[model samples]
Every structure is written in structure tokens, then in C-alpha cells.
Target: MSDHLVKVSDLQIGFKNEEGELIPAVRGLSFTLGREKLGIVGESGSGKSLTGRALLGVLPPNAVVSASHLSFENTDLLTAPSAELRKLRGLKMGMILQDPKYSLNPIMKVGNQIIEAIQVSNKISKAKAKKAVFDILEAVKIRDVKRVYKQYPHEVSGGMAQRIMIAMMLVRKPDLLIADEPTSALDVTVQESVLDILDNLVDERNMGLIFISHDLNLVSRFCDRVLVMYSGQVVEELVASKLHDAKHPYTRGLINCMPTLNGSLEPLPVLKRDPSWLGAAQIGSGK
Candidate 1:
């Protein structure tokens, strides 16, 4: 068996305009993921979210996706049938979306939703599924598991709702997990708690994590390696600890654009856009 859990090569995603011309959103993105945390950092519309959605085969109907190779645990994602892909989605791979309010069903109780997910992927009875749900909720550090189980989505706080979302995805014990800005909506303390849960779970399960976010500092502290994207293409890759030493001008510009706690009272640096950076994709050694 290969060491890589997910493999994507020369992946391109686009859409057709009124003129039927292909307008690319993700251009030739390639990388391999093992049982490790890999962070993709870039601004909005840089195809960070699209890349994660594409892997789950959840792109919009109008999307035009093509890739030289896209596979999950040796399963050919590009050619997999809808039934196969559907089965793979929650059973072997799970995705934690950015916001729980938008992702969860407003009418359903939280426990029932997670129980439904558990039952869908496994042939367990409701009793067993409920037990699994509670276990996962506790695993994610939800103290009042019983109360949370009966409460509706809106009844819980944003942080608790996000934890519920995490519990739902993790109940299945997937091999690959995609977290699209899971902590983006939480406050600092809650965000730290969420990250701690994710870090512990990933380490304990040996799951491959694709953490998509625009926060370079958070990614550097949490992930093992980083992929810096620009205009739908990867301009640089770096070891997370070495992100500050990024070679690509775009990466450096992004770092410089961040406001420091004690920064000088000057305007933040504006990134100078260069058309040449969008040429051929640059693959870094990630040293």
C-alpha cells in the first residue's frame, strides 16, 4: 500500500461562461497527503475551498473539473461512480465545513442528526448510534453531552455547534479529513479549544488532515507543511515552521500584509500583483 492517503496531480477546476469559454478557478494544483496535517493558505477566491470540495466530489453542478490524477486511498476519484463516491464520502472520508449553522439542519436535534449520520454509514441500531454520537461529542470536549444531544442547532453556541459538527464527522473514523476554516468563526479561546481537539484527534487516529484557511500564522503553528496559493495556483510550499522564510514574493507579501501586535503606525503593505506569477505552477521542495 502507498504511504499517501490522498493524491492529486495536475488538477484543474473551471466553469463555462456565457460564451462557453472555460474560466478556471483551480489551475493545475498538485500534491500528496499522508497521515499528516497539510495546510493550504491563500486569500478568498484563490480556490482553497474549491480544492477541498472537488476532492469530496461536491462541486457545483456547473463546475468543470479535470485532473491528470485524483485518487483517495488508491480509489480513482475521477472515475468513481456516484454510488461509490457517495459511499466513500462519510465512510472513509469526512469534511468539516466552515460554519455549523449553515451545515446543520435547523429543525433536527443535534443528537438525532449525528445518530443519523452514524447509522447511514454503518448498519448499527439507533441505540448503538446514539451511544457512538455521545462518545464522539465527549471526544470533542463537549462537557454536557446529554443536554447537547437533545438541543437544536440554534440552541448551542457557535463553538459548541462547531464541536457538534466535528463530532459528526469524526464518528465514522475516516482516514482523510478536510477542515475548511473550521475555527474561522470562533473567538480566540474557542478557536484554541477547537484546534486542540482536532490536533489530538488527528494524532490519535493517524488521519490525513487538509486544513484550508487564510490565516498564515495559525497554519504555521498547527500544520506540518504549507501550500501557499495565488490566483488558483500554488506559488510556493514550505515547512510550517519555516513559513516565515518563504521564497515566493507572493508568500512574503502576504506575511508582510499581516498586522502585528506592535507593528509601526504605518499603512500595511499592499501586495503588488504580477501577471507572471500565474504562468506555470511552481513546485517547492518544502524544505
Candidate 2:
């Protein structure tokens, strides 16, 4: 197996507009992931989520996706057949969507959903799969597995529901996990707990994690390295601990926009955009 779990080069995602002209949403985005946490930070429309979705071939029917190189381990994702992708999706590469409310099935029991996830690639018996679900739910910190198993998505709290979603993905023990703002809706305290659980699991499983979020502060603190994107381009990549020392003006502006605890109480500085930034040279490999 390759040390690089995911390698994306010159990736682009485009959608057809009303006039049938293709407009690129993610342009020339490239990064490599190993068995560590990599954060993608940018504003809502900056193409962060779309990049993650493209990796799993979850883009909408009309989406125009192309890449020079988009490979996961030894598999070439762009050229892989649907059957091959299906075999790898949950078993080798799992994705945790931003919200469990929309992601989880409203009609089914949470435990059943997990069992279904486990059986996506495996031919295990229901009894074995159910036990796996229970064990996985417990691993994600759910105390009453049997109780939560029978409950619907509406029955569980937001935090617990998110944990259940994590458990569903972890049940397969994927090598690469793409989490898209898993804790955005939760309160601050619950958010930290969720992140802690995610981090611990990624480390314990020796899996690569791609954490996508709009919160720069959270990304800097949680990820091993950070990729700062703007207008569909990754302007900078830097070690998370040295985020404050970033070279790109866009990265610096994002860091500056974050409110400081000890600094003066004056109005925060606005981020001034530069059109040339879209065409600027990118910096640093995540390594």
C-alpha cells in the first residue's frame, strides 16, 4: 500500500449554468493525504465540500468532474467503474456528511442503518452485523447501544446523532475518512467532544482524515496541516501549529479575521480580496 492514501492533482469540478456554459466551482485543487488529519478551510462557496464529494463520486448528475490525477491508494477514482467505487466507498473510504438530520434515514432505526452500512461490502449474517453495530456504537461513545439502536434519527440529540453517523462510517473501518463539518450545528462543548472522538478514532485506526470546515480556528487547532482555499484554488498549505506564520495574504487575512481573546476590543479587520489571488502560485505540500 502507498504511504499516500489519497493523491489529487489538478482536480476540477464544474456545473452547467442556465445558459449551458460550464462554470468551474473547484479549480486545480490538489493535495495528498496520509494517515493523518488534513483540514480544508474556506468560506461557504469556496468549493471545499464539493472537492470532498468528488472524491466519493457523489456529485450531482449534471456535475462535470475531471482531474489529471485523483487516486485513492492503488485505485484511480476518476477511471474506476461504479461497481469498483461501490466496493471501495464504505469499505475503504467513508464520508461523514455535515448534518445527520439529512444524512440519516428518517424511516429506519439507527441501528438498522448501521447494520446496512456494514453489510454494504460484507456478507455477514444479521446477528453478526447487529453485534458489529452494537460494538461500533459503543466505540463511538454511545452508552445504551440497544436503546439507541431502536430509536429513529429524531429520537437522538444532535450530538448523539452525529456520533451515530460516525459509528456508521467507522463500522467498516475505512482507511480514509472525509468529514464535512460534523459538529457545525452542535454547541461549543459538544463540538469539542465530537472532535476529540473523531481524532482518537483516526489515530487508533491509523486512517487518513480530511476535515472540511469554515472555521479557521478550529481547523488550525484540530488538523495536522491546513489547506486554505479561495475562489476554488488552494492558495496556501501549512503546518497547523504554524498557521499564524502563514505566507499567503489570503491565509493571513483569515487568521486576522478571527477575534482574539486578549487583543483590543476594537472592530475586527475586514478581509480585503485580491483578484490576482485566484491566479497566484500555490505553496507547500502538506508533508
Candidate 3:
């Protein structure tokens, strides 16, 4: 078996533009994941989420996807049959999207949603599924499980709704978890709590995580390794602890923009764009 949980080489994702031209959103991106937190950080249009979605074969129908190698736990995601990909999605791999408000069903009760999740891949009765749902709700650190379960997505606060989303994805105990800006919508305290819960669960379950975010500081402190993306390609990669010493121009620019408590109260540095950085060789030889 491969030591890595996920491996991608020369992956490219593009969409059709006006006049039928192919507009590349992600190009020549390559990375490998193991049972640890790996952060993908970039600006709004850097294709961070696209990379995560491609791993699950969940890109939009209009997208054109190609990769020299795209494997998850030895299964080739690039050519996997639709039925096989569906089977792998929730059972072996799970994704937590950015906002719970849009991701969750506004009309469905949270409890029933979770119960459905537990029953989708496993052969379990409603009674057993309810028991499992409650257990998972507790695991995600929901204090008022019963009350929250009975409520609709619109009834709960953003943080609480996010916790329910996490519970839904994790109840299946997938081998790989891709969390795309999971805590971006919550308050500071709530964000920290969610990250703690997620970190603990990943360690306990020995699951590989691809945490996608725009927060460099959070990724530095929370993830074991970090991949810096710029203009749809990985520009640099370094250990999270060594983020301050990043060498790539794009990585350094991102670090310079983050505000520090003791630093000067000056305006944040503006990131300088360079056409040369677009197709440059990524650090760690990912090119």
C-alpha cells in the first residue's frame, strides 16, 4: 500500500471561456498527503477549493479535469467509475465546505440529516442510526445535543450549524477529510473551538486532512505542513513552523501582509504581482 493517503501529479482544472477558450484555474499542481494536517492557503481565486474538490471527483460539469496521477488510498480518482466515486465520497473521503447555511438543507431537521448520513453507506436501522447520530453530535462538542438536533439549520447559530456539518461528515469516519474554509464564518472564540474539535478528531481517527483556508496565520499555527498557492499553482511549501522563513516571493509576500500584535501599526503590505511567478518552479520540487 502507498504510504500517502492522497497523491496528485500534474493536475489541471479548467473551464470554457467565451469563444471556447480553456481558462485554467489550476495548473501543474502536485502534492501528497498523509495522516496529518496539511494546509492549502491562497488568495480568493487561487484555486484552493478546486484542488480539494477535484480529489473527490466533484467538479462542475463544465470543468475539464486532467491529471497525470490522482490517487486516494491507492484508488485512482481521475478514472474512477461514477458508482465507485459515489461509494468513496462519504465512506472513504469526506468534505466540509465553507458555509453551513448554504450547505445544509434549510427544511430538514439536523437530527434526521445526520441519521440519513449514517444510513447512506452503512446498513443500520433508524433506531441504531439515531443512537449513532447522538453520539457523533456529542463528539463534535455540541453541548445541547437534543435541543440542537430538534432544531432546523436556520434556527441554530452559525457556529452551531458548522458543528452539525462537521458531525455529519465525520460520522462515517472517512480515511481522508478535506475541510474547505470550515471555520471562516464563525467568531474568533467559536473558530478556535471548532479547530480544536477538528484537530482532536483527526488525530484520534488517524485521518489525513487537507485544510483549505485564506488565513495564513491560522494555517501556520494549526497545520503540520503548509502549501502556498498563487494564481492557480503551488508556489512554495514549507513546514508550518518555518513559515516565517519562506523563500518564495509569493509566500514571503503573504507573510508580510499578516498583521502582528507587536509589529508597526502601519498599513499591511500590498502583494506585488509578477507574471514570472505564475509558472515558476514550486518549492519542494512539486513542479
Candidate 2 per-residue C-alpha lDDT over 168-256 given as tens digits, one digit per residue, 9 for 90 to 100: 98778888899999878778887887788788878798989999998888998999998988988899888888888998888888888
Candidate 1 differs from the real structure by a C-alpha RMSD in angstroms, to one decimal, of 1.6
Kindly report which residue stretches of model 2 are placed more than 4 angstroms away from their true locations once superposed. none
Query: Over the stretch 1-287, how does candidate 3's per-residue lDDT look in tens digits?
Result: 88888999889999998799999999888888988899999999999999999998889999999989999987998777889989999699999999898999999999999988888889898888888989988987789898988999999998889889988998998889999999898888878878887798778999999999999989999999999999888988889989889998888888898788898888889889999998688555322
Shift of residue 224 alpha carbon in model 3, Å: 1.2
lDDT of 2 at 249: 85
lDDT of each: 0.90, 0.88, 0.89
**Of 2 and 3, the candidate ranking higher by TM-score:** 3
Give me the runs in candidate 1 sitting further than 4 Å from their true place. 284-287
> What 10-residue stretch in candidate 3 is worst by lDDT?
278-287
The better-scoring model by TM-score among 1 and 2 is 1
Which candidate achieves the best lDDT against the true structure?
A: 1
Give all TM-scores, in the order shown. 0.95, 0.93, 0.95
